[model samples]
Target: MLELLGLSRVGEAVYRSMLANPRLDVGALAAETRLTERQVRTALDELADLALLSPVSGDGALRAVVSPEVGLAALLASAEEEAARKQRQIEQTRAAIAAIAAERSAGRSGNEIRRLDGVEAVRARMAELALTATRECMSMNAGAADRPDSRAASAPLNQQALERGVVIRAVCRESFRNDPETLAHAHWLVGLGGQMRTVPTLPMPMVIVDHRIAILPVNPHEAAEGAIEVDTPGVLAASCALFEHVWATGTPLGDAAAAGDDGCLPQERALLGIVADGHTDEHAARKLGVSLRTVRRMMSDLMERLSAQSRFQAGVNAAKRGWI
Candidate 1:
């Protein structure tokens, strides 16, 4: 009980002895405590001054007395008051610490801005921001570059956020053709209660949350060259608006393609299908079990045959040509 009151070992022993043996003479108390008479008397005087003890007899025998039950109750009450005071002090200290941290982060600018360069750096930043997200998160995927890495990093963070009751929304290229990996990732996000949509073409690869944080690729071609983190409200809001615009015209990736028995050139359809899934030269080559050079040559021939300027345009041209 004395320990709960924040008393030292000696103080606790003295107090407990007084409580156990009320109205004991100084010498008897000393004997019970295994302390010298002088030491016991000194402790008793201190306790009395603290209003924990009093004189119970009129005789001059130095028979120190413990206070009444009401006094003991008051002492307990004082301890409670002290505990409450300390708790309040602790809370104030924590608030100060949080304020300092916020100020430090808010003051960062220019060189203080973390410049993540390279694929590893970009992945790390995404993971960091995803983990720190509190209320909501938004994402837009342009070509699905680095998607595998992004999904891997987001999975655990998404799970944690769901457990913490955060909302997540993701927008991807509408052309996704239900590739095995992309489909699995879409299902995972949807199962976690995340909202998702597909757009014909994302304005950019970016992420924004709560109008306070944003991440966008530094170089569209070299996705591994990292990205810039934006904290400015105006910039983040603009990015969010762009995402919303695209999302409004987007379709759900899962509904992009349907089973068909109508006759069509299977190779042309398959090529278009893979392109829609965001496969680059190397990716399409591996998926088709063909050499990189062969895939490149075939892609050139397909583009020329369709009279298109780019791979994406070629895919559209193929559809327009009634080949897929």
Candidate 2:
């Protein structure tokens, strides 16, 4: 227990032995504590340094143990003072960081929305944002990139953020589960305490950090086109609202898709909604991050279930039954 106050085990043993019998010399202490005489001597030196052992009057060969009440209380008080000093330093450092962040932010217009012209620029800005994020990291992906190199590059940063106790939430298309590589990445992220959820479709690829900075693709369907960085309060609020809405409706990763109260799974409902919007099977497939064949198969099963002969009839039937 005294170790917390910088007391070594040998020194504590020697001290305790001396406290029990003040007349015990170094040899007697070693014999009693089962430590070598050299160890006892070392302990004696340590105790003397700590002011726990003092020379006994008129006998340089004998030593006295300072009462633990006085010696330990002094040590405890010193440790507390050191801890307080460190805490103050921590607070000062935190304040300095806040000041720096604020000064940097003030230099930029509060409502500025800057365009990042190329993928490299976007990647560089993203790295900067990720590095400075102090709170939550949120993102919505229309689909996984499924690029091993990109995933490998991002793993270290993601792991670092997670280790720093940052909260991470991501929403991706459920069809990513169909791809082995994407599924593995999602599982790996979740295993590291990062949260992941899935929806049938996402509007676009977007990232928001600390609820203050947002990065949005220039084109909803093509992230390679580049992105825009926005710190506008209104835009950030809207972006956060959209994320929360999608997140609330999403299924947790690894969960089995189940039918809703309307007798249609989320994927089925999303497909029906997409078809109702006059999109082709290919368009729906792209939005859902699935293959055209999968979209067609799902449509076929839905039509059979509705006992409708055509897509239009199925839509009408679904509407009448409140399935869409």
Candidate 3:
């Protein structure tokens, strides 16, 4: 019965002692339970806090005692309350699980893809889908100015997605390095363990996920215009292939420091080779006869292209995206 009530052994002993001998002194209670006086006092305080005991006056003397009727009532009430709370929590959990199951079922149906228009609409859909993503996110973004509203729009939803254990992989253009806003955006993505990379060139803003969902801008200059969402295997495959081609030739963020001192556009393969040698930025820059500022600028550009918050994140992103 004590175990059923979730009472520890010591608590059970204290409770039993109180029940058997109401209004007993703390010292007597301790003796009965063979526990220390401090232990008895603590247990009594805990039981009283739980409303299992009541203060009473015995022959004009104040004493703590178990109330035969009230004690039973309090115990029963506590049990009922605990049961109700657990039931409500279980119901909520079940509802959430059911909702997820429904979404997965819908995703697998392979029906028509949903089309959304306007920047606001696209942001809204990305937020919604990002909230639901479980495994991974793949994106091809046109630097920051292309979607000024994306940060605030995608932040909350992206955070929620990360909490759900989704992995993100993003590809952007080399122009991202020059834009502070875009670099900050890349930082946010990297902070969430998402991968970012930059290419020398890009077609337009697009987002692809799990080889199933694709988002493409209808107009190259107008992201807010109607965008198409494609779920077809052929179209998704083609877009994914395009992403791979760019990724293959892009410079990794970490390798920027070692590529050259003169800040020459390091060949992608050569940059990787230098990075593999584990040389420091300063040493690599001196070897190539480039200034520290130039090295830093090149590194910054590399991180921007990779959408990395730090060199470490950039490396991780590049590896995951198969860029390096």
Residue range 1-324, candidate 3, lDDT tens digits: 555554567877888887788757778888999999999877877776666666675674324666547765667778889999998996687468658856775866563566787877887777756755667788777643335665777777777667767877777666566667767777776777777776544666678766678888788666657688888888888988987776676655424423433333433323333444676777444433345675567667767877898767766665665556
User: Which whole-number lDDT from 0 to 100 does residue 247 have in model 2?
Assistant: 97
Clashing pairs in 1: 174-199
How many collisions between residues are there in candidate 1?
1
Candidate 3: give the clashing pairs.
119-224, 196-306, 197-305, 197-306, 198-305, 261-290
Please write out the lDDT profile of model 2 over residues 86-189, one tens digit for every residue.
Answer: 98996687567667777888898788989998778887887766656779999998864467776786787788678768899999888888889888988999
Model 3 has an lDDT value of 0.67
Better of 2 and 3 by TM-score: 2
User: Could you estimate the TM-score for every candidate?
Assistant: 0.48, 0.69, 0.50
- RMSD in Å for all candidates: 13.3, 6.7, 12.8
TM-score leader: 2
Misplaced by over 4 Å in model 3 are: 1-113, 145-148, 253-263, 266-324
Q: Which ten residues in a row have the lowest lDDT in candidate 1?
A: 257-266
- Backbone clashes in model 2, listed as residue pairs: none
Residue lDDT tens for model 1, 33-62: 888888876776666666766665577654
Q: Which has the higher lDDT value, candidate number 2 or candidate number 3?
A: 2
